[model samples]
Target: MSNGTDMALISELVARERLFRARHNPEIRDCYYADATVATSWQQGPLSTFIGAESKEVDPRFVIVGSVSTPVVHLNGDKAYVELPTTTHMRMMVNGTLAELESYRRLIYRVERRDTKWKISRLTSINESDNLRPVIVGQDLHVIPQDFNGLRSSYQFLAYVRQAAGGQISQDLLGTDRPEEVERLYKETNAWLRAGV
Candidate 1:
């Protein structure tokens, strides 16, 4: 396909991703390649983990309120690379007060033409910044403690844990002395993470 066509297809796919994030619609998965992979700056593991992290029910208050710039695309035959820079402002009600987080992210998508259709084969995201200031919005305004610093977000931490478990499984499969123990730990860790989420 021509470069313009490739760019258009990739741009559409990125827009679809944003829509999917806001809506949490499972049908959006159709836009991805069957064996697509994803890696993010703040998170590790496969794309499925990221998808699972999204809430099943969309919260009306927690909505994306911002605009995204046009993506820069590079086309190479059947493959296209796209870089999309976006700044998103999310607002939600927390403890009866309005809370907001402004996040800047650059998303890279690798789209490929498969069977006459374009599909995203891989996606990578770089989190530029996530600024969350404490300011109560009510009859009385108070500052809340910012205790979430120096700690990975829940999604990033969980992804690292899952990656570690996978590594342990691989090592155990390589004829480790304590295969049974490693297997047990892997299963337990997986179960614990799943339950916590």
Candidate 2:
């Protein structure tokens, strides 16, 4: 990245990205570039599909995710790379029992500016780790859901819960278990930013 990068401008875009995903605000299109793309374990394609697939009903037991680390941004002239570390916390009924799934991931974003408008060009994620547990303080998970059968351990519970909720996931998503894929993503996007493409 060139020294001319204005981090302040890039930071605002990051803030708007988070706000656009918040429950209270529903202006998703306004926050993202018209052609932004999103790729993750649960969904891969347009940004709309990723956000639209989420359940609209409000429930305290569940949340889309919880960000644990501040965003790490790399700003170039008209493009930037942003990475936010987050954890997913979702509680739901699994096999007639209340269970929660917590998953850790790195949210990657490719931001760009055109005609003086800054927005996300692509959004991707890399799974780190995850676990499942009974929501109740003293309860135990007895029956392991069939959906969790052949998922990657890094985000197994997350993939299982999402699929059980009528959503599909990509089993070949980038994850901690696959160092090569992670390396590829980082290298490819970083090159994009440097090339100013």
Candidate 3:
């Protein structure tokens, strides 16, 4: 049911997932930049600031557990593309409560051989969506997990608004306003999270 190369790619993906589980923020930082192009999405100023603020509040001990069920591999000459099309279950303790999320991520890993060693040239997260509830209130309050879920379910209906308007709307409406966009994305993403893939 699989080829040797397929097995190798799966092994690579598994290794990366393990690193994520290690929850070593520094390692994640390094892994994120193992290649220049791979880190482009993260270099955005506001995104950087967001990460900086979140990292301070998030404990490295938080655990994320998940699995890879279906993997699609495509090879183009020297470049190989791998897509993980399976459901993943990730749970981590946030603010003293275990917050769980289910989502699917499609990732691409590029490999090259130099001398006798095979080196990963680049790894790109092509697309990823998670179905996790929003942690904060409508961009205003910092609520614990229990509180977040309680209120979130009541207003979960707002997600359709974000999905219909798209991220660009949130950007335009909340432009230059850090808190506004953060709240918009949080709400939009929550709507998708509640949708459940």
Task: Estimate the Cα RMSD of every predicted model relative to the unseen true structure.
Answer: 12.7, 3.5, 12.5
lDDT of 3 by residue, 12-47 (tens): 654664356345444434332233233211222222
lDDT by residue for model 1 over 1-197, one digit each (tens)?
56776678778888888778667678667878768777653334556655655423223445667567898876666666677887766664433455565667666677777778888777765555556533454432133334333333422222222232242112111112335643564464334324422
Give the candidate number with the greatest TM-score: 2
Order the candidates by lDDT, highest first — what do you get?
A: 2, 1, 3
**Clashes (candidate 3):** 1
Clash pairs (backbone) in predicted model 3: 131-193
lDDT of each: 0.56, 0.75, 0.39
TM-scores for all predictions: 0.60, 0.82, 0.42
Model 2 misplaced regions, further than 4 Å: 1-5, 52-62, 144-149, 163-167
What does the lDDT read for residue 195 in candidate 3?
Answer: 47
> Best lDDT goes to which candidate?
2
Model 1 misplaced stretches (Cα beyond 4 Å): 41-43, 52-61, 64-66, 92-97, 134-197
Where is the poorest 10-residue window by lDDT in model 3?
A: 167-176
Error of 3 at 94 (Å): 6.9
